[model samples]
Target: MAKDDLVSIDGKVSSLSGGGVYYITLENGVDISAKLCGKMKKFKIKVVVGDRVTVGMSPYDPTHGLILHRHKF
Candidate 1:
């Protein structure tokens, strides 16, 4: 897919599910299911509930996405 086909959204992790999946609530109030990207796993990046993250969602399906980046602070 082309780079422009993906949409990046900022959200806070709301919960953790089985198999390393996370449920995040976007700033606009949309809830989406996300999974950590390959690089995150390779780097051993930990994602916890309440952590802020950037999710890369497909414009065609906003209900699911991939957690791209974690905001540290």
Candidate 2:
């Protein structure tokens, strides 16, 4: 399946900081800090506050979603 077609999720970017970490507010009202993997960092992609993005969960913690896709408002 295409990446976009995966079981993606949506959340609002709460904050973006140096070193590539971002705080995102999830639809369920929880917040999580996520960063792109080392490979994704090379692309210089940035996720900003209030922007909607897609994410996946870490295997250890499926409840927490990690930013995997982003769409501009």
Candidate 3:
């Protein structure tokens, strides 16, 4: 997947998965797996699945990419 094609969870952080994986449960209840970006990790911001986040990655592999940022709104 290309970095430009990635996306941020418009919804909120829902759950956490092993191996740095997170379950971002969108408003529609469709859960998506996302990992924390390098910057986020450096900042020490805990990312939950229900927490809204911005992601950057390739469309082919949304799972593999950078999480630019996340927010409650």
Candidate 4:
């Protein structure tokens, strides 16, 4: 789906899995798996466990998403 069609939400990285997969816990207490998007990969942005991040996903699939942005605070 297109980027504009994605639903964005804020979450915290809970764990890192093999194969570049990250598990994030959303603000509402839901966990979802996500991966880095193209720009993030190209720029080599690092996301470790406990970092807050923004995830973008299709409304139809809430269990998976793209790690769009990392929040620094």
lDDT of 2 by residue, 1-73 (tens): 3333434557888887787778878788878777664445667776667888877655555454557777866
Candidate 2 similarity to native, TM-score: 0.66
TM-score of candidate 3 on Cα atoms, chains taken together: 0.63
- Residue-wise C-alpha lDDT for candidate 4, range 1-73, written one tens digit per residue: 8999999999999999999999999999999999999999999999999999999989998899999999999
Name the TM-score of candidate 4.
0.97
Candidate 1 segments whose C-alpha is farther than 4 A from its true place: 2-4
Best by lDDT: 4
TM-score for every candidate vs. truth? 0.93, 0.66, 0.63, 0.97
Question: Sorted on lDDT, highest at the top, how do the candidates line up?
Answer: 4, 1, 2, 3
Candidate 3 local lDDT, residue 59: 58
Clashing pairs in 4: none
Score candidate 1 by lDDT: 0.92
What is the per-residue lDDT of model 3 for residues 1-73, given as tens digits with 9 covering 90 to 100? Answer: 4445555445456677689977665555665666787778888987754556765556566444456777655
| lDDT values for all models | 0.92, 0.68, 0.63, 0.96
Residues forming the 10-long window of minimal summed lDDT in candidate 2: 1-10
